[model samples]
Structures are given as structure tokens and as C-alpha cells.
Target: MAEQIELHEQAPRLKSVSSPQDQDKGTSQQDDVDDTGITEASLTLEEQTDLDARRGQGFEAYPDGGVAAWLQVLYCFCIMFTTLGGVYSWGIFQDALHAEQLAPSSTLAFIGSTQATLEGLCAIPISALVARFGNKNVAVVGAILSGLGPILASWCTKSVAGLFVTEGFMFGAGQALCFFCAATLPSSYFSRRRNFATGLVYAGSGVGGAALSLAANGLIKSIGLPWTFRILGILFLAINLPCAYLLKPRPIISPIHHGAQGGLTWGPVVKISLLKDIRFVLVLIGSAVALFPLFVPPFFLPLFATSIGLSSGAASSLLAGFNLASATGRIGWGVMADRWFGSLNSLLLCLAANATSTLVIWPIAGRVGPLAVFAVINGFCAGGFFSLIPGVVSSLFSDDDLPVAFSMIVSLWAPGDFLGAPIAGYLLQAFGGPDSGYEAYRPAIFYAGGLGVFSALMVFGARVKEGGSWRRRL
Candidate 1:
């Protein structure tokens, strides 16, 4: 009987020891939950928490001063300068083309309008493609096309129609490539300092535009338009080479079995999310309306200068000043947005200042000094609009959704971009051209300023609805 009792007690002890092994096996099974891939659902609680923390930090993914990151930035700067510079220098080319080859102010305006429209419109498809194939590959293709377009244009028959095909269609296509590459790459690098990085990249556009305008204007005066275009094409090619080598996306491992197969698919998820987001919709509309007037001044500023008695070289220089000021403004405003204030708050302030500067300052800028000041102020204020937009959009959605959101906004803005410059041109002709003394452009400034004010009010309304004060946030 004692032997039987001892045996029973020993059995209980053995079972207790075996229980821990069973528990460990269960844990091992749980750990295998993500063996297939990395998906949102597969992430551990800790991983999700870490992701949220990173998101809150804003554009912090990029390694500060790392060779790869800085090289990407450098490439972005070149791309920005070439594409944006070309856009900013529209006035110089428009003035020259209108006078020499493509005569009639209204006709020449189509070139700028078409280029801007294409640049914006192309982003929709390009963004998706980049998401699928990766930015480095897409950017290289874009750079080649952009760099070669001008060279091809230089060989075209020099008539309005020919110029339209070469300069408008070809060159515009190139610009679109450069623009997409620059804007998209930075989105991949930094999450916390995104605005600051983006601002710096975009500032290169103004710098490129200013520097190129000065160079192009001087070259055009000395060697004429054909050789000038050829030289610009060479410069574009040189600047684009490094961008092709450097700009790349962050490595993201997918969890779904075929997730990497189709790249980023456009599905109900994208549609539903975008449609449900009222803030995004309003911001997109505001972006379109705001961008409309921004291009008008740069498009016609050189012509306006000539109309007011400045020489061709002097007029071109003013255009350069406008771009130079714009570059400075972008960097300065970006810093303020990233460091001092929230992106949304900075946007509102910029819109208000842009409106005030345009209406209050530009109307009286018939004289040289005042015009210069107005250009600088307008450029500076306008910088905030471009710099803060992506960050503000980012605040509304997660990283995975960013490419689609950005694409949608760009697609929506295409029509407005195409129409803006042409409308300005018609308005200019209606009021008067250089012969009529720029009276038409004066009214145009007021219209642009009014739009800026209206946009600010919309943003303010959104802020109020969100129960936040703009000043407090800033």
C-alpha cells in the first residue's frame, strides 16, 4: 500500500515537468504566424507600436548625411533644377519665341500651358509605375527622355507647329520625367524631416530656373535660339546623369504571397479610402486652385518687364530674380514648416501672405525696385505652398497610401494647370500686350491674389472644423 502511494505521487511530479515543454511548443507555433510574409495583420503588437511612433516623428527614415541618402538628395536637386527651372524660365522663352519664331502672344502661351499640364497629368501614371517598378529605374528612363527631348527639338523645323511638337510635346515630356523622379524619391527617404528635405529639393528648381534663365537669355542674345537650346539640352543631360544613379526606394518586404508580383494594385481599397477622406478632397481642390495663379506671374513676368520699358536682357534678369527669390523662399519656408510650425498651419500663413503680397505689392510694381521686391516676396510666400503640401497630405494618411494620394492630387490638378497660363494669355491680350502697356496683367495679379485669399479661408474653415486654431498649431 505504501509502494502504491509513492508511485502515484511520482506520476504527478512527471506530469508537472512535461507541462512546461508543451507551453514552449505553443509559443513556437505563435511565432511562426508570419512565416509567409510581412503584412499589417502579421505584425506583432510591439512592431505596430514602433511603426506608430515612427510615423509621429515625421520623415525620419532617411539617414542623416549617409552617402546614399545625400546622393539621392543631390540627384533630386538636379532633377528639380532642370524640370522646375525650365518651367520658371517660361517667361524668357515665351517672350523670345513670341517675338522671333512663334509670334502672337496668345499662340506662344500654349507652349507653357501644355508643358505645365503634361507635367502634372503625367504624375498619375508615373507615380503608380514608380511604386511598381521602383523609382531608380523609372527616373533613369525619364531623365533620358527629358534630356534628349530638347536636343531633338533643336533639329525640328523652327516653325510654330514644329516648335509645338518639339518644344511643347517633347520637352514637356522630359520635364514630366524629371519632376516625377525628384518629387517621388524624397518621399522614400525621410519621414520626419520630409518638408525640410522636399523644400530643399524644390528650392533647386528655382535656383535651376534662375540660373538657366540667365544663361539661356545670354546665350540666346549672343548665339541665337537654336544653339542656345542645344546648349541647354547638354546641361540638362549632365545634371540628370547622377540622379539616375542615386535615387532609389526604401526596401519594403511584402507579406502577401503575390504582393510583389503585381506591384501596387489600384483597388477598392484606394478608391474607398480617398473618397471617404474629406480633408484630402479639400486639400486637393485647394492645391489645384492655388497652383493656377502661381505659374501666371512667372510665365509672363519677362514680357511684362519689356512692356514697361526694360531691355530684353533686363527683363530676362527680372525673371531670374523671381526664380532666385522663389528658391530662397522654398528653403526658408520649408525650415519653418518642419521645425517651427505644423505643415497645415504654415500653408495657411503662406496663402495669406501670397495673396496680400500679390494684391498689395504687385499692382504697384511697375517700377523696377518695387517689382523686384514683389517678386522676392511672392516667391518666398509661394514656396510654403509647394513645400507644405506633401507633408500635410502625409498627415492625413499612412505611408502605404501616400503614392496613391499624391497621384490623385496631381491628376486632379492637370486640367487647371493646362488652362491657367492660356487663360492668363487671353486676359493679357484682352487688356493689352506690350503695346497697351501691361494693364491686362495688373488685373490678372488681382485675380491671382483673390484666389490665394479664398484658398486660405477654405483652409481656415477646415482648421476650425477640426477644432484647432491655426496660430496655436503653428
Candidate 2:
């Protein structure tokens, strides 16, 4: 039964029906506040549309399983196929650098790290930039830059520094641009299936790494490195170009407020104070902390395998188990979130499983059978760590506030992504048996497990904070 309260006068403010955790903080303000903390205004005869006019189009109703919607998912996969293909395939390029002889191993390693770091760091600006310029505009420039970066890198085969700028900085920036374009749009298209859609989108990276690795291996052999890069450069644009054309933001209405025109300003995009939202703040801390160690396995697994007495070939082959399992985990976890677990719970499950695998299985994975098993377990559980992100973040905000919530939450991953593996590496070097390749990685393994421990605990805290108790599912 629904009842209406009769007001003597029209209220100028909008009431927020926000999460349980926020009610206390929300009450502190005398004025009604939107989820993002902006106060509502009295309707003006000068020219004002009401709340209905302010809703973004797609979230009100998802297209669900339309051909057009599914096509966008496919397009996201293509973007991942190319962008993360490059990200994951950095090892191939790192190996090929020996032929160029322009830089030492330490110097060459920077090239890949720089590309990755830039990709992560630039995401904050790119997410907000999408509000100003449409997804297609940003994505097209990304496609152009992605293709041009490597094409230009091909010309500078003799100069490591030139490759650094072209392949590292330019390529990474382009990936960031194209990446957020695909990543941010999917949430608006499917509410019930948002996790499933996002899962497929992120699973693109794993799929890309597998596909591109084989292609890169063969391409480098048949055509040679420079030509291979040129071919890949061409391929990058070919894939992203169509995808960018199709990517679009849901129609939005930014309501007009006092003393200004009705348009998004640089102000909202640049605001970090939004971190003041407790829900947003906890999510940021939890995500960054989880990712700080969550990223270790992909970077160190093969190397760790070799240290355990496995042949280099066998160690490399083991990576397939992790990658395939990751793709499966992503889709599976997304389904779980849509069905039963919900975002925070599903994420907690993943982090717990990942941490357990790292501590118990990975430490003893030196044996061939144990190594394969650990790889499978880690990949399956840890894969959802990224896939579940859209769910958790989406739960924190209403449709109106989704853009800022998404941008701010995801921005945390940049620093975590860049720093995780390096921190793990330092631990290995410091604690591993002296001169024993990966034998002394015990301390590093513990470090990874420790990160997982804290990550899981922190998210549990956030989930409880959101829902107010264990009796509720978040």
C-alpha cells in the first residue's frame, strides 16, 4: 500500500533515498541532497524542467539482449583484444628488444612499465572527459593514437628512447582513451545483467592476451619485429575504429541550476572532494588495497614456474591454465552476482578465494601438478576481481550518480596496478634465497597473500558499512 504525504507548500528540495550507511551523514545537512551531495533547487519560471527531464536514458531501461546491445559487447571485446593484447604482449616485445640492442634489460623493462603506468594513470581524466566529449570522439582519437604509436615506433627501431615515447607513452595513452570508452558505456546498457556484460568486456583482456600472443609469436618469426609492429599497428586501428564508431553514452539531461547554463562544467570532472562520500572512500581504499597484491600472479607466474625447476617452455605453457581459468571466472562470477551473491559479496568471495590460493597453493606450486592446479585456482578466482568491479561500484550509486562513481572508483586501480608487481618483485629480491632464481620468493608469496587478506577484510568492512549488518546482502 502506498500513501502520499500532503505538503502545505511545494518543497524546493529533492529527498535522497540513499544507502543505509549514508543516512547519518545525509541527515547532517539541513537541505535535501542528491546522491552526489548537490542540493535541489526550486523550480523557476525563468526556464526549468523537473526531475523526470533529468534522468539518463539507458539506465531507466536497459535494452537487455538486443542485437545492437550484444554488438557493443563484441566491440568491447575487440577493444580489449587489441589494447590488452598489447599490454600482455609486452613480454614478447621485451624479448625482441635483444635484437635491437638499443637498451639493456633494465632499460627495456621500463618501456612496458611506462606503457602500463600511463594506461592506468590516464584513466581518471579519460573517464571524466567522456562526459564532455562523447565516447566515439574520445575512442576515435584513441584508435588513431594506438595505431600511430607503434607505426611510429617501427620507424625508430634504432632508438630505444624513441620507442619509449612511441610505444610506451603514446600507445598507453591511446589504450586508456579507448579503454574507458568501452568500459564505461556497458553499465548503462544492462541493469540486471550489468555484471555479465562487464564480465565479457573485461574478459577481453585475457582473450586478447592469448590470441595476440600466438599471433605476435608467429608474426615476429615470419615477418620480423619492425614489420610485425607495423602489421599490428594496422590491425589495432582496424579493430578499434569500428568499435569506437558504435560506442555511445546513454542520453543524459544535466538539469540547469542557478547562476549557470545547463551544461557539464570542468568543475565536476576535476572534483576529488567527492572522495568525502564515505561509501566512495571505502570502495577506493578497498579496491586499491586489493589490487595492490591482486596483480602479482599474472606478472610473476611464469617466472616463478621456472624457479621451481620447470623448464622455461613448461613454465610458459602453464600460463595458459591461468589465462583460460581467468576468462571463465570472469563470466562465472558475473553470473553469480546477477543471480545470488550481489556485487560486494561476489567480490568478497573472489578475493578470499584468490588469497587462499596464493598462500596455500602457490607457495607449494613448485611441483608440476601443484603448479598447474594453483594456476587454475588462482586464475579462476582472481579473474573476477576485475569483472566484479562494475557491480560493486554500481551498487554504491544511483543511475544519476553512476558516472562520477565509476570514474572515481576505477581511478584507484591505476596506482595499484602499476605498483603491485614492483612491490612484489622487491620482496622476492630481498627475501628469496640468494642467487636462487625464484627459490626465495616465499616472502613475496606471503606478501601477496597478506595483501589479499587485508583486501578481503576491507571489502567485508565496506559491505557491512553499506548494508549496516551481516543479516543483509550487499
Candidate 3:
């Protein structure tokens, strides 16, 4: 009842809900218990209304898996293709800036970091906007920013500072809004196949990254930098504009639990009290610490490959391999989590794989075979890590609280991303050598693996604390 009042205070709408009067109808439902000793609450009038409506209307089930849901997935894919894809593909630009413009590695790193910070900065706020004004409005504004940021960047090719503002900050902010929509909108369409849908949507990033890697490598080599930026900007606009119109949140997403309300207030205020949740705090810390290293590969892998004397063609190939594997991993791990392992366990296994690949495999990857293997494995595991984040968030909270929890999760990613690249750059500059780049990359590798392992441990601890056993759901 208190939660319902809170919801009423937040979003005033005609969303279907059981009236408080239903509780006084003298229904007794405390007798049901599940396998875990958790009592099952009886269905409320609102839920029965929903169930009957769907059944009689022959409307889609909780997970429709039909045209509407698929369209939502496609919309999310388009958003991620431009937004998260851009983030993943930044290494190509960083490499170009290093060689053609001769920017310092640290400076380039910081610029990328700034963009990452700006991108995550609005994730929490945007969730509320999506709830209030609808998803399409936020997407349109984001599409414009995403399209223009790179176009504006093309003219500033010679100036690193100028490019920083245009490419890093502008593009990052645009990506942030798109990312916000992508993360939230799909849930409105899917309930059962949500993890799979999210995996498919996130796979769009890997697809975009792989395609952009191939395109950037060829376009920059053939036509030069400015045109490449222009083309990319055009592509972002072309693809995202359609998605902006098409993507929408469904009414079905707003479900009331018992008499509790659905939908958050479409206001500026967001609940930050999860900071007090020990499990939530652990998840936050795990997210931040883990984020730092996960971004390292996207920012530096191509450069690392080239520094070790791999040709640009070979480096692009390796990066493409990484991206393809990442896409595969995104889908694979998501399937595993939904079907076999569950979210938290899948995340632990994913982190373990990433740590192993980074700590054990990467150090030995000076040659093409080893490096390619390392790249693919690392990318796959990293994809798993990214894919599981939403599931983890959803698992820790109720459905209505999902937006709040995820907002906090994505927003908190800023700090880790802002610092991750620069830290890696400095470590590399201090230790990398002319003869072999392995020595320099070692510190960053250790840093990534250590943080990943530490984050995994934190998550595991949270799991234990929440469930009191590894066997418990969480």
C-alpha cells in the first residue's frame, strides 16, 4: 500500500491496478509456500484482470515473441549499433589519432574516458524520461546527437582538443541516451525471453563493431579520415532515425504487483536509496571495478596488436574476430543464464573466463595465432559480462524497481570508464618497449584481471549474503 502510494505520487495515469478495496474483500492467501520456504502471495484482482484480458482477447502471452517484441528488439539493436558500437570501435580512431595526428597516448586515452563518462552520466535520468515522455522522444533526440557528433568531428581532424569535444563528449552523451533506451525499452515488450532479447540487442554492438572495424580499416586507408567520419555520421543518422520512430514502450510493461503500482514518476527525482543496500552496493562496486578493465580491450587491442608488429590488416582481422566472438558470446551466455546457470552464476563464470584469458592467455599472445585466440576468448567472455548485467540487476530487485536499479548500475559505470583507459595508457607508456609491447601491456593486463577477479569475488560475496548459499536464487 505504501509502495502504491509512492507510485501514485510518481506517475498519475490510468494504468490497470487493483484497488485498495480489494484487500478488504476478505481473501486469505498466506497458506501457499514454495520450495524455498517463501510464501506465495495470491493473485490480485488487477492480475486476474490482466490474465483474463489476455486470454479472452487472445493477446500475446507475457512473452509475446511476435512481431511487436521482435520489432522492439530491432529498435534496441539499432540504438546499440550506433551508441555502444561507437564506444567499442573507438580504438580505431584512437590508433589513427596516435599515428596521423601524433597525439599522446594518455591524452587520447583521457579523451575516450571523457566520452565514456559523459555517456553514462545520463543513464539514470533518462530512465525517468523514457517512463514519462515515452521511449521514442528520448530516442529521437539521441539519434540527432549521435548523427551530428561524428559529422562535427570530421572537420576537427587536425585538432585533438576539438575532436575531444566533438567526438568524445558530444558522441558520448548521445550514446548515453540511446543506451538508456536500449536497456529499458526491450523489457516493456518481453517478459520470458527478455534475456535472449537483450542478448540479441547487445549483439548489435558486436555486429556494428565488427562491420565498423572492417569499414574503418578500408575507408581510412582508401578515402582518408574526414570522409570516413562523414560516412559514419550519415550511417548513424540513417539507421537511428527509423528506429527512433519505430521503438516504443508497450502498456503491458506496466504491471502491478498485488495492489502495488507500476511505472515510476516521470519526474527529475530518482531514488538513490539502493546505496544503502549491501547487495546493491556490492553490485555497484563490482560493476565499476569490472568496467575499468573490460573497456581496455576495445580502447587498445588494435594498437596493442600493431605495436607488436602485426600489420594493420591483421590487427583489423583480429579485432573483427574479437567482435564476432563477442556477439556470439553475448547470445551464448545469455542463453546459458536463462536456461542453465542463472544470472549470478553465469556472471561468476563469465568473470572467471575473462580473468583467465587476460591473466594466462594474453601474456603469451605475441604471435598471430595466440593473439587471435586470446582476442576471441577474451571478447566472448567480456560479452558475457555485459550481457548478464541487466539480468543481475533484475534479479536483485522487483520488476517495478528494475528501472531504478539499472539506472543506478549504468550511471555508476562512468567513474570506471573515465579512469580505466588513462590508467592503462599510463601503465603502457611507462612499461612498453620498442622490442616488444608485452612488457608494457603486462601491468594493464594484471590490472584488468585483478579487478575482474576482485569484482567477481564481490559479486560472489553478495550472492552468499543475499541467498545465504550458492544454491539460492539471486
- Among the numbered candidates, top lDDT falls to 3
The C-alpha stretches of model 1 lying farther than 4 A from their native spots are 1-65, 251-270, 469-474
**C-alpha RMSD between model 2 and the true structure:** 5.8
**Candidates 1 and 2, the one with greater TM-score:** 2
Q: Write the per-residue lDDT of candidate 1 for residues 172-289, one digit (tens) a residue.
A: 8777766766774565566556677878888888898888877877887898877877888888888786776677755331111222232333432134567676776677777778
Query: How far in Å is the alpha carbon of 268 misplaced in model 2?
Result: 0.9
Name the best candidate (by TM-score): 2
True lDDT of residue 89, candidate 2: 73
Report the Cα lDDT for candidate 3: 0.73
CA lDDT, every model vs. true structure: 0.68, 0.72, 0.73
Q: What is the lDDT of residue 281 in candidate 1?
A: 68
lDDT of 1 at 81: 86
lDDT of 2 by residue, 1-474 (tens): 001111101122343322323454764435445334455444454323543343222114566678877888888878977886687777777767765677775577777777766755775677667766778888899988888898898888778889989998899888888887887567766778888888898888877776776788788889888898899999998988988888865443111122233333453543465566676677678778887776688778777887777886786677766777887888889998888877788898899989999999888776889889988888888779888876786776555455566666666777777778788878877775325765688888888898888888888777777765554445
Q: Which candidate would rank higher by lDDT, 1 or 3?
A: 3
Ranking by lDDT: 3, 2, 1
Question: Each model's RMSD to truth, in Å?
Answer: 11.6, 5.8, 6.6
Model 2, CA-based lDDT: 0.72
